[model samples]
Target: MSSTKNENCYIIKLGREASLSERANELEAAAASGNCRKLLQLIRATGSKKSDVSETICEDDGMPVTNSHRCLERWTELFEGQFN
Candidate 1:
């Protein structure tokens, strides 16, 4: 039934959330201990390949922005303003 499918989806989501939380805790501990290799491993494990953006761009104020989400958000705002 649809309800059973929804319950299965919810359980899967919860399992993923728990796994991410555990990885985050491990990452925090690694960072506190200055374990760069373990930190990078945890980061890579927690991050998705599809979300990886290696390109660096500049913000509107000329500050360098290397984060993909921030770059996308800035560009979206700029384009939205031009259209509106």
Candidate 2:
């Protein structure tokens, strides 16, 4: 981490992972924009969630599939119930 022009909001440096792909770059761009809705749309349109994992994800018959609107809705509902 290095401070610019003195201090008070120093930039934290991250060691780059050399294997980053094009899709990873796009996702990073969307994430860096700080607009959650746009990132969500990109993720939804591309179905990027859980797509890179090597593990097999077996969804139950009634469970919401990953990267879908239903999964997002289910997550929101679950969190609302938990915190409310």
Compare the candidates by lDDT and give the number of the best one. 1
Q: Cα lDDT of model 1 overall?
A: 0.87
- After superposition on all C-alphas, the RMSD of every candidate to the true structure, in Å, is 11.5, 16.6
Q: lDDT per residue, candidate 1, 1-84, as tens digits?
A: 999999999999999999888888999999999999999998887777786656666887889877878888988887898999
Off by over 4 Å in 2: 1-20, 48-84
lDDT of 2 at 60: 45
Worst 10 residues of 1 by lDDT: 48-57
Cα-based lDDT at residue 19, candidate 1: 88
Give Cα distance to truth, residue 35, candidate 1, Å. Answer: 0.7
The TM-score obtained by model 2 is 0.29
Listed per model in order, the count of residue pairs whose N, CA or C atoms clash below 3 Å is: 0, 0
**Which candidate number has the best TM-score?**
1
Candidate 2 residue-wise lDDT, 1-84, digit = tens:
354543533322222233235557777888998878878876786674555644233244665366666666666776787999
What's the true lDDT of residue 10 in model 2? 32
